[model samples]
Target: MPESTPFHDLAAFIALPRVSSLALSPDGTRLVTAVQELSSDRTRFIGALWEVDPSGERPARRLTRSGRGESAPGFLPDGTLLFLSSRPAADPGEGADDKQEAALWSLPAEGGEASQLLVRAGGIDGYATATAAARIALAAGLLPGAADAEQDERLREARRKAKVSAILHESVPVRYWDHDLGPAVPHVFGVPDAGAEPSVMVDCGARRIGGSGHIAVSPDGSLIAYTAALGTLPDEIRDAVVVVDAATGKQLRVLEAPDAEFGAAAFTPDSRHLVCVRERRITWDSPGDVTLWLADATDDQDPGRDLLPAFEQWPGAPVVSPVPGEDGTPVVWFTADEGGHAPVFRLSTGSGDIVRLTTSGAYSDVVASPDGATLYALRSAVDSPPAPVRLDAAASGQEPVTLPSPGQPAALPGSLTEVHTTAEDGTALRAWLVLPQDARPDTPAPLLLWVHGGPQTSWNAWHWRWSPWVAAAAGYAVLLPDPALSTGYGQHMHERGWAHWGGASYQDVLALTDAALRRDDLDGERTAMMGGSYGGYMANWIATHTDRFKAIVTHASLWNMYSFAQVTDFPAYWMRRQGDPLENTERYERESPHLRAANITTPMLVIHGDKDYRVPIGEGLALWNDLARFEVPAKFLYFPDEGHWITKPNNIRLWYATVLGFLAHHVLGEQWQRPDLV
Candidate 1:
């Protein structure tokens, strides 16, 4: 290990600067990234903007500073940098609130102090900028029955004075993943220019809810495309792309189908066409599919053309190239999970041909240059943190040039390798094996089988919350696998575990673990397993099925299938997959981990957050009670003010410390010791 690296220190690892997003200038001469770090008090992570040389020559430099920090970096046509901040206005009379919501701010390209550009009564949730038309669109919240800004403010003040926190709902989705909806509806507004007040472009209607899923403005700035809910019921609440006149806010077209959901809209450079992701809705027996679709902006009647009908992998957000092909066809680029790697690919609108631009690592926040010859993105893998990289958009199987990044992570204390195996159904499964630096054949490292969340998601990119390096640094070999329901393996792989979450997925996970344990550097005897969310559910399931491991750590996991399906933030979504528990009791009885709680012999640690509506606090309380009833060794770590994922710096530090301590006690045969400041 390098002497300068602090991989062994938990404090240093938690305090390391983390990058979340990237934005390239319209001219592609400059790139900006959002780097988050522990605040002065080390209570939370705050973000600031940093500039990087697109040419990868000069080192990166900080561009903005504030106690509240800045984020959502964007570039206007005039080269001015735009961002969102809650910082007070320079002038006290500007009506700046010290505890105010986030507002739009601008910093000149030539270098100067950033100033407030636009402020809304509800602040700005998100914004999009148009380079060619020099326009900005913002997503803001508005109170019901309020038609304008003044009315909106009056409504807010009235509600506060009345000490009311109630929201009446007429829709099925009364609550989202973490919070209740209503009281204030979301709308999209068109800001005439910087420092100018915005005008409401779309009301989004009360029933529409959740505002727009993904918003995009045409290059010519004449039209705007966004995603909106199609209906109010849970199953009927499908998303569709809606295009409207930018200035008048008159609806022009609605692109949708009975069985397809559309989102992540992007307009072509010429503004003649639009491309968005089309996902086929899943059913009881069949898994859904995702592909790209090209829609004609001029004619609303056209159903649009499929761009990659035969592509097996599910693509991420679509980004249209600024430059067209030689035949005047628009070019689109997107990143997708293939095997264990997430790479960038180019799709020709004319030929419907796909070209892979990158071969390894995961790429996101893709930005294309004006000429479409070069692409910029943030790339990361299991062994690396996110860093800016530039790649040839037209190249095949090429590596990207790493750009100068600010506050890059310290070198790892260990290395990563790939482990592959064949499932019972003859399907190939793979996982990343992270081995500690000191592991040898005679003295093997203790194995930590860490399952990933998003049962539908793959372990293709770097993650801050569930980082495997922390375990590896603690001298445990971590196995990150993508089982049956994991993406990137095509539709059939997902179908195998569609409604049967505990069947093939569980077997595949065990199969991959069997393969990894066969390696000489890993100790099969001194092993433990851990997971969060869906992975947490699996840990509980594994405990019930087998005692192969000595300990298990389950975080924000689902324990009771019937209750979880009905009480989760998205009850309808889960019900759609598992069917109504009242009617489908057999599936729930057979798969739910709680049903076999008596079979769990492995000592376990349960972690959950009170604010996590996704899994809910009730699930954690019930799991703890069940463990106590069954006489299984258990401890419950509860957070009073956190969501599905722990975000606060101190909270995250404690999470890592506690998990490490738990594993050390059970797997390393050490005395149980509590993490400090718990």
Candidate 2:
């Protein structure tokens, strides 16, 4: 058989054919999941919907009974299941590509033939539709039409089927946060519920929610409030909550976000008001605060009250919570960064009184159910994986109900050890080291110090990836560090590397290496580094600054701020974070690894998606040219039809295959097939 792919690899995992979705039933007693399954013999794989009575003691039962059809499952408040199913893409396996043709289906909770709820010619994303609320909301994607690629398609197909012609008129669309089907194309809005048909209240126009967007309904059903983009992502835009007319899709008023960003806002159970978490995003220093916005439905213009400045940062802890009052007007029931812990807090919206809920050292994203009777919170930690906690939150006020892992739990290697070490500047850098189970201190196994890309991001709290997992399975130790900039800790800790690109920030990984050397489980002689985006930048930095590693793999990396400022998708953002390269030209030179290509002596494999606008592939190409000119060991890997992320199963398989082989050969000192070598 082909080499036993590790559990972490996409082929092994996606190959399992399972679905993962979170949908709550109308009564909240039943939860639905969209799962895919393979026949017992393992030849055929099927995608279908399944429901489990969270309150019952039974296995989940299948809901959808169709062909290779069904995915993106959601729950409607009235007890119906809404989902998207794979339909015939005019181009066959193009799947949900150009046609965007997945038929939206709604099936009764009791069960029956699924009915098509909404079927448009094209354009849709994971959607939101009310069960009995009479409104549906979906993101509209940018459609690529016949105006551009018809000639190429016609010529290519003419040589094949002879009859196959390019019939492309309009294709896929760019999906965004807000859209109202009533106004048609180009216009979008926040969803509304007027007891009549649902409409949009806030317009997205060309704006997008760089992350996730949530729409909230008032308990009274007379008003609607939704998270909306006030700016464009070219600037990496932030969003705000707006009060909207439930019937006309009209924006009554918009709550001005105090910080550059705000998130996951929710209304009180009574629906007369809402509370939002405000956060500034200019630097690593986050000023996390909670602000309340109110609208009485009758008072249109002055719906918002004075911004309540009630809480401050709690170090090492982050809680996700928004309270719509249990019985009275909605108060700002939230969690704060109080005394270095993210315990749940019940703060009175009217009086600003703070009450501590959970004293646990970690927790986040807490949400109370519609009736204010149940609260679901996702608890987190640096080394601890995330688990759900359901609280009565009211009387009896019982303990929390912990949620189970998504599908099957990640098969973490038994050798994994959580450790903390001191960086060059004495900052504490934490890491999760996974050594082979049989690895002995004398074995000297190769090390793969996997730097999480965010620089502002992190790899922690149950880190699972197909790439690193396979690397570990191949006899390499994977070091995952939440260096700095990783949230969970207060903003101060995350902002540790604000503008210090390769300064102290770069030394942390090396320091982590020093720490690993002290550990008997790791092999200090053979080591390699890999990461994407910001992590990619650091891989280049380490490769150039030190000749210690045997090999390196960098993906979607930014090589030069000078060129990157102009070519990247987030131009304004780079300028904001790094200061205009035009002004701080010298800093860009000092920060970029490209300036010292001659110094990098490690065997390197560079990969990039050609269509990735985030960290443009030009940076990768530039590095490849420099490495070749300097006779430094290197090769360039490119994916033509991909974005910052590789989505197509074929590309994903190919991409990881290359990295796996590269590391196996260089770091593990084992002969593995790799195109880079060829």
- Using lDDT as the measure, which candidate wins? 1
- Provide the clashing-pair count of each candidate structure: 0, 20
lDDT by residue (382-436, candidate 1, tens digit) is 8778999999989899989999886665788788998999998899899999998
lDDT of 2 by residue, 1-678 (tens): 123433555556546434344466656666666565554444445677766545435655777666555887666667777788654433444333434356566787777777665443333444554433644444443322212123323443343466543333221122221221211232233344313222223333322444345555544455555556665334545666656655555676666543555545555544555555544556323323234444443354553553345344422212212334544545444554333235566555556565666654345545455455565555544333445456655433234555543343445443557667777566666666777645677676678888877665455434333245566666777887666555444455555666567776677777777888787767788888888878888898988888888899998888877898777754665676666766667668778788888887899999888778777778989988988988986777788877677655556666777887887787766786764323
* Candidate 2 global TM-score: 0.77
Which candidate comes out best when scored by TM-score?
A: 1
Shift in Å, residue 418, candidate 2? 1.5
Candidate 2's C-alpha runs over 4 A off are 1-10, 17-19, 36-48, 65-72, 85-98, 126-186, 189-213, 231-238, 257-259, 283-371, 375-406, 424-426, 461-467, 675-678
